[model samples]
Each structure stands twice: as C-alpha cells, then as structure tokens.
Target: MIELKSAGEISAMREAGRVVAGVHAAVRAQAAVGVSLRELDQVARTVIHEGGAGSSFLGYHPSFGATPYPGVICTSVNGVMLHGLPTPYRLRDGDLLSVDCAVHVDGWHADGTVSFVVGAARAEDLDLIRVADATLAAGIAAAVPGARMGDVGHAMSAVGRGAGYGMQNDFGGHGIGREMHESPFVPNEGRKGRGLWLRPGLVIAIEPSLIAGGGDDYHMASDGWSVCTGDGSRSAHVEHTVAITQDGPVILTVP
Candidate 1:
C-alpha cells in the first residue's frame, strides 16, 4: 500500500528531515581520520537525542537480517556499501566513509545518506564520490509529478555509468512516511516509463551507489550487516528523502 501524507503531514515530515540532515552534518564534521566509527555513531545518537527525535535504526530488525541493528547510524567504509553496523574500527587517511541515518519525529520518519572522504582523496575517489552525489541529484530531479519511478532510476544509473562507476541495484530507496521503509520499493536502475505513478504527498528516498573498480558484483560481509564489493573495491553512496509536490520535487533533507 502506498501511503500519501496530507499537506500538513508533509510539512511535519520535512521538519523531521531537517533534523536528519543536521545529524548528518554533525557526524561528517566529527568524522576525521583516527576517529572510530563508533564515535561517529555516538555523534549521530547525540544529535538525534538533542533534536528531540527518535532513531529509525536503533534496534531495527528486518526480515532479511538475522539480528536487530545495534547502532544508531550505519558506517560504511571503503569496500562496504550499505547496512554497515558501526563498530570500534578507527578510520584512517584516504578512507571513504558513507553514513546513513534516519530519524522519527512526532510520528514521521526521514532518511538520508552522505559519503565523505576522511583525508586526502584519490582522484578516482573524488570522482566516485562526485558521481554518487550527482546521481542522487539527477534522481531527485526526476521525482516530479507525471514522471514514472523508472525515470528516477535511469537518471541515477546514467550518472554512475557515465562516470565509469559500477552501479548497485540490489538495494535502493523506498516510499517513506510514518515508517522508514514503506511500500513501493524504488530501485536505483529502471526503465523510464513503468511502476507506480507519482502523486503529491508521496515521500521517498533516492539512493545511488557506485563502486570504484567498475564491478557491480557485491558480497555480504561476515558481520552479517555490511555489504561490500566482491573485488574489494571502494564504494560510495548518496541519498536524499524527497516529496513529489506541486512545485516539482522538494528535498526535505536540506534547508
């Protein structure tokens, strides 16, 4: 079932999204080299609590996973793609970290992800991160009413492929409202004219993931949480929660 929010409810979701974005910004600021991944998660926990919001990931257990998530935020480093459980591993120079977060405020949920380079970034690393960001932007641009879900996927895939990066389609975005993950799974790659039609008040997250080695295959990490590239290549992911409004797509996870 696709859930649509009212104008007033959408306003509240946007507010929740602002808090999530703020949390991401705070985590990024504290993610310097030598900082442990657990430290970053602590920053996220603090920001969410300080913002008077509940974490969408705390103790979250999905059918696909064996155990409930144990951290407040996901910390995917280099080879890891998604579902990276925050651990005591300390970051180092040139480590590419992707932080994924979601928060629930007043019964509404908003999710977003941001990728960052810890120290000096390699040339290709910079390109991979840029591609992920651009891919997310393209997907958001295609979130207008009258546009099919495939349009967003295709746009995101084009950005990744054009930059010579491998795109990951196993995990993508989804419709978000009262819950973090709702109905109507939104893939990162799709044909241009299929799937559910866009309507106002429908909020969703559009995430684009790319690997540096140009290989699309991935493997599940032994931790049973993180997903990494099969060839041990670095990866980057970018995401944003947006709503299809009368004024095109409104990026709720931004100011």
Candidate 2:
C-alpha cells in the first residue's frame, strides 16, 4: 500500500535527502580522470558515515539482484547504464560517469543520481547529460498535488523521446520512504491523464536514464551487477526525490 507521510515525517526525510545530496557532492568533486571507481565509493562512504546516515544500497539484495550489493553507491561509466559496481578500473579522460546514491536518516530514506564527464567532455556526451537533466526536472515539475502519476511519466518521456533517446523498459523510479523501494512503481513513460492520483504528502523519486543510441536493449555485465548498453552507446541518468505538498512539489533531495 502507498503510505502518505506526515509533515514531521517529510521533514525527517528531507534530512535523509540532505545526506544523499552530500554523497553526490562529494562523489562529484572526487570523480576525475585517474580516479578509480572504488575510491569514489569510499568518498561516498565517508560522507554518509560522517552525516550519521546509513546507506540504502549497501547489502541490499532485491529480487533481481544475484547477491547483496557491496557498495554504498553505484558507479555507472559510459555504456554502463545502471547498477554498475565499483572496481579498480581508473577513469579516463572524456569518460561519462553516473553515480546513484541513497541514504536513510532516522529511518527515512531518500535517493538520487547524477551523470557527468570525468575530465574532458565530448559534445555528444554533454548533450546526453543535458537531456537527462531536463527530463528529471520535467518529472519533478509534474509531481504536484492532484496530478496523476502518468503526468509525471509523460512529462519525462516526452523530453527523452524528443531528444531521440531511449529508456530502460524494466527499470525506473519508485516510491521511497522508510524503505528504499516501496509500493507504486513509477514509469518513465505513460499517458498524461492516467495512473495514480497524486495526493498531498506523497513522496517519490523521479529519475530519467536516457540511452544516446535511441535503443532500449541492454545486457548484464560479467560481475552480475552492472547494466551495459547492448549497442555500446553511451547513456546518462539523473534523479531527485520529490514530495507533493499543498504549496507545490518540493524537492527533498537537495544540498
């Protein structure tokens, strides 16, 4: 069932979101050419620990997962779309990297993701990241009270489609509260007037992951965790945790 959060509960969740944002900030600052993915993960770990927040990704073994997740954050590089495991591989100039993170503070959870270039950036890669960021903003704008979930999805998908990008069919954002994953799976594409009605106190993560080659096909990596594009094309992912309130849609995951 979908659980509505109270004012106080939402406040607590904002705290968790702050920690998630901090992790993203630290990861972004530390990610560069010559940096190993494992080192970036450690940066996130330090931020989470110092914030007194627990990682939502570590030890998480979802039904589709082959084993418990071993990192505090997912490090997706270039063709790696999602669930990319951190490794000893050092980043190279012009590499596209996406970091996904989640955290819980005082039992409330928040999740978010960001994509960027390691050092030197290609024009196409910058364009891909721009579209992904735009889609995420569109999704958040559609999260106001009384709107339908499909409105949010439609808003996001329209941007990606217009940019000639494709999204993963099986993976998208989800309801987040005390648990990292909750009821009411949120899709990236849908009819504007369809799906669940958005009510005040409703909280959800809005993430848009776009494939530059305009294909939806992807395959798992040998590590049983990383998801890479089937066509070897690059991708970008961005996200935010938003809450619907009487005033408007409030983004909880901000630094």
TM-score, per-candidate, Cα-based: 0.98, 0.98
For candidate 2, write residues 1-255 as lDDT tens digits: 999999999999999999999999999999888999999999999999999999999999987788899999999999999999989989999999999999999899999999999888999999999999999999888888888999999999999988999888578899999899997788888789999999998889888899999999999988889988989999998989888999989999998
lDDT of 1 at 166: 88
Residue 181's C-alpha lDDT in candidate 1?
94
Backbone clash tally for model 2?
Answer: 0
Q: Pairs clashing in candidate 2?
A: none
Total colliding residue pairs, candidate 1: 0
| CA lDDT, candidate 2, residue 34 | 94
Alpha carbon lDDT of residue 40, candidate 2? Answer: 96
The CA lDDT at 223 in model 1 is: 84
Task: Give the whole-model CA lDDT for all candidates, comma-separated.
Answer: 0.89, 0.92
lDDT, residue 106, model 2: 89
Tens-place lDDT digits, model 1, residues 152-222: 89888888888888888879999999899997788889898987888888899988889999889998888
- The local distance difference test score of model 2 is 0.92
